[model samples]
Target: MMINSTQVSYFTLSAYFDTGLFKYLCFMIVMSLYVLIVGSNLLLVVVICMNRSLHEPMYLFLCSLFVNELVGSSGLFPFLLVQILSDSHTVSAPLCFLQIFCVHYYGAVEYLNLAVMSYDRYLAICYPLQYNTRMTYNKIATLIALTWLCPCCAMVVLMSLTSSLQLCRNTIYKVYCDTHSVVKLSCSDINVINVYGLIATFSTIFGSLLLILFSYVRILRVCFSGSKQTRQKAVSTCTPHLASLLNFSVGACFEVSQSRFNMSTLPNVLRIFLSLYFLTCPPLFNPVLYGLNLSKIRVIFKSLISNAA
Candidate 1:
């Protein structure tokens, strides 16, 4: 299939925020958000690591979570910040591929981290006695390693497959790098590639979420059969994770949908607004939701403050 003939070998992007006022506003907002996500997640990691009381399977997973959150955010935020502030948002072919790979890599890791965390909770709540035995330091290390490895494995396959494809010209509709956006740009036969990518992503997402839901259901059943206080505590402990999963799922769905359909029905401003919200909101909320809502984490924060004072 011949693309529209053009001497231009690459497509350059215009800044999403064309107006000076909007650019400055977005720069400030996104910068503030990046700082919050990085700061809060780092603090959470330190609190978990520095305190011997938190040296358990559960907090171990939380620390892994903070690291994953930072990894995921760093994959896109710095480049995005530059793009948002610059006169041009254009990126090169190699950089575009790198962006696409990093996104799926860390994004998939985030999902896997959630699954590991859910399993950790299940063991802690449902089988407290066996928790230590089942989730030893070595076991926790394996889980953390898997969290990073699984995503890296997928990304390597995905990038290898995508990089092999011939891209006629780069026409990214969205502000940031997205898998489908990059896939759609391929001039070669992408039918099989798209199908594989779609299946892999959907299976990873739906499969992990299904397992989490199943574990939580059993957890709730066990809690309900026990005491009322036990039930409340279990539910509260699960709330932050539930909220995080929900946000992540919603954002993924929106991103996939926007990629699938031509989003021309909505105005550009509204489209960009939704995209930005989906991309940035979940990471920012993850640490806050857990830190504020989980009593243990709140106590840790208090101790951290008291010790500092």
Candidate 2:
């Protein structure tokens, strides 16, 4: 029996295992993580916005990155907490699709934002003399706009395509609502949607990756031959970005692979951990990375703490 999109009222998530007495523990852990992600990301956002000195392109980009963390985590954690506590791990159709939209949109924006940040760093490090003039306010605004808007547009299409499909099954074998899982349930032919999804995923991931690569290549060349001061400047600014890029890329690769390939041999706990890593780690890792590494943010944060004390 096949059901059209309208008839499929809810999706049952089968990834959640019975933790029995530990379900309450899981709930507390997830709740704590959500609070931390929100608190840390919000703190940096507020810090960047309030300080006029921190209004540079780099800080502004960091602000956007932090905000994206909030957006991504919000999409996952609340729904996750509820699912963990609920005996029936089911989500309404509308809510599931919304989660899909938010999660995918968050991912696209994250890559684009990082790509633009790499370009910003490339300018600041390689062309220090003209950094101010070259990275103008208008250009920064445009880059930020494109970063967000492009993802928003792509996700709208992806969601539309996914939502229109006639699902043969309503069970998703994952802890969260993902596009691939939904696509797999389609009773109708989804070759076109699959191809479009591939194109979109490749273009978003590799397109941003290529730009990041080009920027870093030039950055590396300058770092090797340049003076000690130039090298130090590059290290200070680029370290966090590189760490962030590497971390996210690894988690994302595992997630994509898990989604596309047969990974049933792996333990369910391991699968759950790897799948959630990309979503959970970046939000927690980034604030700590940038906060400690960047002097301006660190100093300002300390002063704020002292003042509050």
Which candidate gets the maximum lDDT versus the true structure?
A: 2
Superposition TM-score, candidate 2 onto the true structure: 0.98
Q: TM-scores of the models, in the given order? A: 0.91, 0.98
What lDDT score belongs to each candidate, Candidate 1 first?
A: 0.78, 0.94
Alpha-carbon lDDT of model 1: 0.78
**For residues 139-178, could you state the per-residue lDDT of candidate 2 as single tens digits?**
9999999999999999888898998888988999999999
Residue 96's lDDT in candidate 2: 98
Residue 144 CA error for candidate 2 (Å)? Answer: 0.5
Error in Å for residue 211 of model 1: 1.2
Supply candidate 1's per-residue lDDT for 271.
Answer: 81
